[model samples]
Target chain A: MARAQELAMRDYVQEVSALTMRWVHRLRREKFSMLFTLVQPMLFWLIFFGSLFQRAANSEVMQAPNYMSFLAAGVVVMTVLNNGLSGGVDLLFDKENGFLERLLATPIHRSSVIISRFIFVMTITSLQILVILTVAYFFGVHPATGLLGIAVVLLIGMLFGIGLTALSMAMAFTVKSHGDFFSVLGFLSLPLIFLSSALVPLSAMPTWMSMLARFNPMTWTIDAVRPLILSGWSQALPRIGMVVMLLLVFDALCLYGSTRAFRRAIG
Target chain B: MGRTVAIETLKLAKAFGDVKAIEHLSFQVWEGEIFGLLGPNGAGKSTTLRILLTLLRPTAGHATVFGHDVVQEPDRVRRLIGYVPQERAIDRFLTGREHLLLLGSLYHLPKDETLRRIREILKLVDLEDRADHLAKTYSGGMKRKLDLACGLLPNPKVLFLDEPTLGLDVQSRLRIWDYIRRLKERGITVVMTTNYLDEADHLCDRLAIIDGGRIMALGSPAELKAGLGGDVVSLTVGAADMDRVESLAKSLKAVPSIRAISTKPSGIDIRVESPEKALPAILDAANQQACRLEFIEYHRPRLEDVFIAQTGHAIREEFPSGE
Candidate 1:
């Protein structure tokens, strides 16, 4: 029995790895797109938004050394959110071109296909986060928890990103076209990003808005990651633990929804 | 008939809401033979292939691949078959070699074994020289060949080619036909669906003719053609007298059977037995009725005539726009 289980696990790993490599090869071929995804967020946080709020750092309303330091964590998490939500475009194109049907006709476990999408999104999101951090460091913004905090921030981004990526995949299977997908993305992205503490801290927001941000998973992630970049481990560890638990629950729900949608679409 | 059954469907049915895609679809594909499902557009051929490939669930009844139930054991069914759908499924960014390697891994082949098979398939499909280039740069025919190469990577027991030559120039179509023949030589069972009668007649060892979700006829191409009798006699009458010409031809005793008498824009087509003998009688009858004979011709029966004889409508008429 144990031998059979081991063999099954090995097969699952092999299938996921193979499917994930398909997306990896695509990323390598479309280097311009990768460069754009990475650069767009840095351009916003470092150059545009950083200078916009540079003078606010000395005011009581902003409680950090510089706005860039405060906004750096937000930008990292935003990159994760943006990449995760748009990840389903690949699946959409696959469906339109009949590649998804070909993949479903194979003997590989169905969930492995979805898992590969998450792996691809998370991999790209990790690289984007690393680049953003490196750029922020040169501009005099450093993590209080140092290398360990950077690792924690990556974990937080991954946990949060997985749920969004799974949700996007579910939408990909359910929607009829890329137009519908773009509409849904346009409808949800700005609201989710703005409602969270990515741009402004919850304490600086209206009481009702702050309360609503508390329920947003993105808010939980940004709150955990912000202290790691702005303060030290003493202020960030508890919130980091809470965000991990919250993200686990979110991923479970999103994965369940996506798997169900996938089955229906393939059937 | 002595061969083992590779795929069997018993009263299989599928429906999309109120639209019945396939109903009571029952047929047996012999092992190591090239079997075809021939029909025009919207004739349930694709739906049947989808069910057999375990890509769709049957609305009623059952289908089995190598004795494994399609719905109950889809993974097992999938393991035994490789499907190349009508629509092209090539990713533009991935090179031909990468596509094969990716599918090979999905099939659970060992890394070294997959590489070996990829090399072999690239050669088999005559794509070795360009296998490392991005598929986006390949022509339509080359893309199709690459798709076929990917399907062959697993070396499945049964290969399903759904309209494998649907949209291709003559040379590419013939190349695919050669690949299907080679697949048969290796003892792999092939189940293909095509609306092209010539393709079905030349490539399939036996075929089932489907129309509107039902099988109208089933047999080898020769058997089906032979069933329509000996020869076809076509008469082109003046456009105004086409109906009179059809009625006159039907009145002849020498032309025992009127396989199909369809009105063309210019004249009428009349298929009958022993056209050499029937031709004179047909012309005499037309002359007796003073029906103008613009043209007349006689030829051996073909699969298209067989389809018209069985279904009472030409395959082209079924899909006028040529889907």
Candidate 2:
């Protein structure tokens, strides 16, 4: 029984860690792509939000005390969503090239595989978000909130990253091909980014679009994280709670779907 | 026999939809034996190996490596054996040393031990000089050698190679055969598959020929060939007067020791206990019938003849050469 347990530990720690390390190695080798994660959001923050905030550097139309400050928080959340969506493409490649089949042959803890992917994507996404936030601070988006708000920013970004990454991985399994996966990205991600108050105040959008934004996962992520970084850091629980609830639901669905896909692929 | 059977499969079976890949397949490889899973394409050779390695669940039945159940106790089985797939599974972006070190870690080798084993494996496969190069930049033979090195990193009790030299050039194939032989000499149990009869004949201590998800023949190379006859007298007859050639060869059936007469598209290939004794009678009968003989060749019976004896077609004809 002791030997059996030892073997099980090997499967969990060694096997799963190696699989995840591959993802880290892949990201490090293609370090150029991280530029897009940073530059893409920076471009939107400059053009769209820059024009809207030019008239009033500090006002209610910006929804916070400062417009650039409000928009910077939104930029960080969008960065997380982008990384999560692209990581799904990696899963599609595994399916197409039969690498997943090779991975299955080894005796490894199944959940470790997914959990490792979550950790890797979340790490890089948070780093890129930090870079964006630092740039915004240089441009005069000062935060009235304290250290607690900084922790909230990091926590919300990680939870959002894991949730969307799980959903994308689930898509990699259900979708017929890599092309199908990227097409879903094209159709779903951009609109979700735009619909949320990631670039503008929710009140600015028409009533119908505002209702959709309220339902959108991206909206919760931005709302939960923005207050912490901008000024209203005290009223944090409800928005953070909403983001947490949505993240848990998405994680459950994605983990369930990927496990099923794993079995099916092995068959 | 050194300790126990290194690998065993009992009534193992797998099916994909309506097509069976393996059916009630059973075999045993002793602790240090070089066992070959020889078969033509689609004969379920790789399927059987996959089952033994615990990669795919058997539709029915069970297999074990080093006395550990492959299905019920796969982690135990994985600890005892290494596997080299037909396609290279190494990360092309990683250096050869990195691939081996990572696999060694997965196998739970201590860090220092993992590095030591990586160096040793690279030396064994003669890949030490290319250890730092990315695997993608290596040629086919070099990549294959690195793959074998990865398999050996953990010092496994048994190794499974699925068509290790399938598409390799002649020199590379021979190099693989030599490495496999060296492994066997060190008392590592090996289970390998190949569609090439010569590969089995040259490298395997014992072989099993499978077809249509069943083992058609099994034995050592000499033993399988000896079962057919002492030699074969293969003759090519002109396309003209085919009936006359058949009738004339039939008339010589009175010859004392022609064990079997096999026919090929180009000629009648006959297996005889003694080629010299039967050749005169066969030739004289052809002369009497006025049938022209285009070619005649005689040699000791080969494993191809054994395959012919069992399956009514040469192995090459059954599994076509080239692709």
The candidate that wins on DockQ is: 1
lDDT by residue for model 1 (A1-267), tens: 999999899989999999999998998999897787666756566667887888865535657878888888889888888888998889999999999889988999988888898888898888788888998898898889999999989989999999899899999999999999999998988888888988888888899888888888889899999999998988998998888898999999998998888888887
lDDT of 2 by residue, B1-323 (tens): 24578887888899999989989788888887789988788889988988887778899987888778988887778778887878876676778887786676677677899888887788889999999888888999998898788778768889889899977998999899899999988889999999888888888988888888988888889999988767888888888866665676687677787877756666687778777788898898778888888889998887777876777566666455532
Cα displacement (angstroms), candidate 2, residue A114, comes to 2.7
The prediction achieving the highest TM-score against the true structure is: 1
* Candidate 2 pairs with clashing backbones: none
Task: At residue A134, give the lDDT of candidate 1.
Answer: 91
Docking class of 1: high
Task: Say which candidate scores most in lDDT.
Answer: 1
